[model samples]
Target: MNTLPKPAMRPARPEFSSGPCAKRPGWNPENLSNAVLGRSHRSKIGKARLKEAIDRTREVLGVPDDYLVGIVPGSDTGAVEMALWSMLGPRPVQLLAFESFGKDWVTDVTKQLKLDAEVLDAPYGKLPDLTKVRKDADLVFTWNGTTSGVRVPNADFIAADREGVTICDATSAAFAQDLDWAKLDVVTFSWQKALGGEAAHGVLVLSPRAVARLESYTPAWPMPKLFRMTKGGKVTLDLFEGATINTPSMLAVEDAVDALKWAASIGGFTEMKRRADANLAVLEAWVAKTPWVAFLAEDAATRSNTSVCLKVVDPRIAGLSADAQADFAKKLASVLEKEGVALDVGGYRDAPPGLRIWCGATVETSDLDALTPWLDWAFASTLDALQAA
Candidate 1:
């Protein structure tokens, strides 16, 4: 068997794991030295820092002034659950689920919340029919399918004058994609994603319409204290002002502020989206030339710029049994990891046998450029080993 030589170049920092993704270029732990620590989160200083995180988030992300942005616990999951538990019972619900996380929300709505939602589902690589989404029903979906690497092309399908609230889990899409804020009633994301900050905290942005729903309607089930956004049938204005329901990691808040400041310094959301798009272009060019692999997203329009997923299309790999195919893909990822050229580039366990790479805003485009050659090398080496054995 012919041996493939390792690539000469490597990604400068290979900490790509999708969630908890690559940090901002030139990031250092020293940046968080001024983090408000060893103090009560309710203290004036702590609240000031938390409010700074929220203000900077709105500034960088171009969130409208009327919207309420709050720091929530449990990362993106908590934010989504809170929205599901607090505001969904009043309206007929429709769920669009194309990938793992989206399906999880479907489960939350159907089994946990016990809401009789109409679930519109598609296989991992495709999107549910947007035309079928009802204007009268509350809609739940992830703006980007993180595991499958399929993202909604745009918000055109959502009716501008619709009566329903559109709840979007946009953890992967928040900084990396252009969110149509006017179309989304409830938008949730985590700092651990695009900003590459610490986890365990979520940012929830509520449109005025959503806040109205929170005030007007109460869920049929018990609302956990952490999920409660209202008090005395009024939207808790303090939460949006940085008074958190639970004690938060001040260190994480500091990390997020650092990241947000970095993002603003580098030209904010436009530049962030550009960086992600450029990274995706790097992978797209490589996939175009490399016959062995193809994107998992069936439509180029739906291809994610953040979590880019790919599948081995070579007959030798594709022809294998399901388990064998998965093994080969894992072996390919393992080879890359062992070489230290890439890290955590394996496909999601529930996703098809392939590769899932983080191309979020924090990832350096040059790193992706450097990493592609290593990917080719790993594939060649792994394929050679497979044929020999």
Candidate 2:
């Protein structure tokens, strides 16, 4: 019997799950000490804190002056649903779905909303042909697919003179990528992703066009209070001013403010994007040298800088059955977990059998650098364990 030699370096923080990603480098429990807990969210101080969250988000993201940003219920999902249910039925919808979250939106529009929709879907690692998308139809898509690690390279495919609105789910892309605000009418994200804030609340940004669509159109179906953003055929401007549609957690609100302040302290979006890019570069360098791993996204342009998904390319592992490959990937993750080198690096449950590493802004590149050798060690260790069995 031989003992596997453990890697010398370890990540200072091992909280790498994609959604509730690693918190900002210096985050501490004390950051939430000023939270207005045990108080009414509608109160003056609470509302001010919520408004600060919205205002800081706008300032950090460089959102245009006329664009309205609001805090909504249900995190990113809530914000997206609110937009879809409110404004989708007015025009023909074209949904581009390449991953699980995008596919979920397709299901929502086609099944739940029952709108006149054209769903353009592709397999896990690929994107739908953007050139083929109808220019006149309302567009809905994820800017970055967390599960697939495929991100739309840019907004060039969208027509500049298109008649309808473009709704974007940018939960994982917001701070990590450049968003063409002129091309997107609606953008939604949660605090949990790139900002590394607490979840439960979603940030919804609306262009003038999106506001017009909401005020002009009414859905045939009933809009739950949770999904309601309009009142009496008018977009509620109060929502943008920190008047939430429902009760919100002031504690979460304060945590979000802390995260946003951290973002601003570090040079805002450019710094965030740079950090994510560097983190992904760490994996890209390793993958380029290691023949065993390949990016799940076939095209380099479409590969995500946030959730970096990788597939096993080594013939010894790739030759196995799909279930066996899945098991192998799980074993690789378990080995790293047991060694306390990494956590939650497994592929999404519904995604292809592989590993998904989060490279969001909140993660330190040095941590990723330390984790890389551990990944190689874990893979080799797993292979040995399999052979011994």
Candidate 3:
């Protein structure tokens, strides 16, 4: 048996799944000490904490003053579903699906909602034809395809004066990418993503247009309390000011506040994005030199800086059957996990056989640099071990 020498450096924090990503650099359980755990969310103190979370999120993200930000039930999925169910029937819809999440949304619109939806789909590592999208129709798309590691390079595809609203599921892109608020009508994300806060809640942002749609046009389907943003045929403005439609965990709210404050302290969105970019740079450099691996996203311009997916390019691994390739990828990830160098680096089950490394802002660049060498070691070891077996 050939024994591979272990790498000297390891990431201090090895919690790198895309959702519930690595927490802020110095996060500890005690950070939630001030949570109003045993009180009503509508109570004055609890409301204040919730409002603080909303206010800080708006400020840090530079959301336009006209836009309304609300804390909604469910995580990113909940927020996205709420928008899709409430706002799609009034107009024709154009849906883009390049990854699993986007594909899920497509199913929701085409099968569930049963709306007049034109779905534009791409393969695992590519983008759909944006040119075919109709400006007159409502557009639904993911800002970043977490599963495929592909992202829309810019919002240029969205017209400045479209007739319908643009609903965006930006769960993975929220903090790391620059959102064009003027070009978007509905944007949704969860606290568990780029900000690295606790989950069970989602943040939904609505443009004035989105609000108008809710208030003026009611959906044909019955709107549950969970997805209801309007009351008595009017937009419930209180939801934007800390009045949640459902009970939320005060502990999670406090953690979100902590994450927002940490974001502001580190120079806000720009600094957070810079940190993620740096992490990606470290991995990109390594990928350029490594012959055995290549980015899953074929276009460099569309590659994601956060959910960085890489495919096994070595002939030995890449040439294996699909099931074998998937198994091999799993074994490689397990090798790193057992070595304590990385964790949760496996590709999404529905995605192509590859490794998905979360390079979100909370992840330290030094850790990524340390982990890269370990990746090389793990690959060599996995190949050697598999051949022997």
Poorest lDDT segment (10 consecutive residues) of candidate 2:
1-10
Candidate no. 2 TM-score: 0.98
Worst lDDT 10-window in candidate 3: 1-10
lDDT of each: 0.93, 0.91, 0.93
Model 2 lDDT tens row, 204-296: 999999998888888888889988888788988999998999999888888889999999999999999999999999999999998888999
Task: For residues 1-389, write the lDDT of model 1, one tens digit per residue.
Answer: 64667778888988778978988888899999998889999999999999999999999999999999999999999999999999998779999999999999999999998999999999989999999998899999999999999999999989999898999999999998999999999999999999999999999999999999998998888888999999999999999998999999999999999999999999999999999999999999999999989999978999999999999999988998999999999999999899887899899989998999999989988888899888888889998998888
Q: Which candidate number maximizes lDDT? A: 1
Tell me the spans in candidate 1 whose CA falls farther than 4 Å from its real position: none
Model with the higher TM-score, candidate 1 or 2: 1
Which ranges of candidate 3 are over 4 A from the true structure?
1-3
Cα error of candidate 1 at position 334, Å: 0.8
Residue pair clashes in candidate 3: none
Estimate the lDDT of model 2: 0.91
Clashes of each: 0, 0, 0
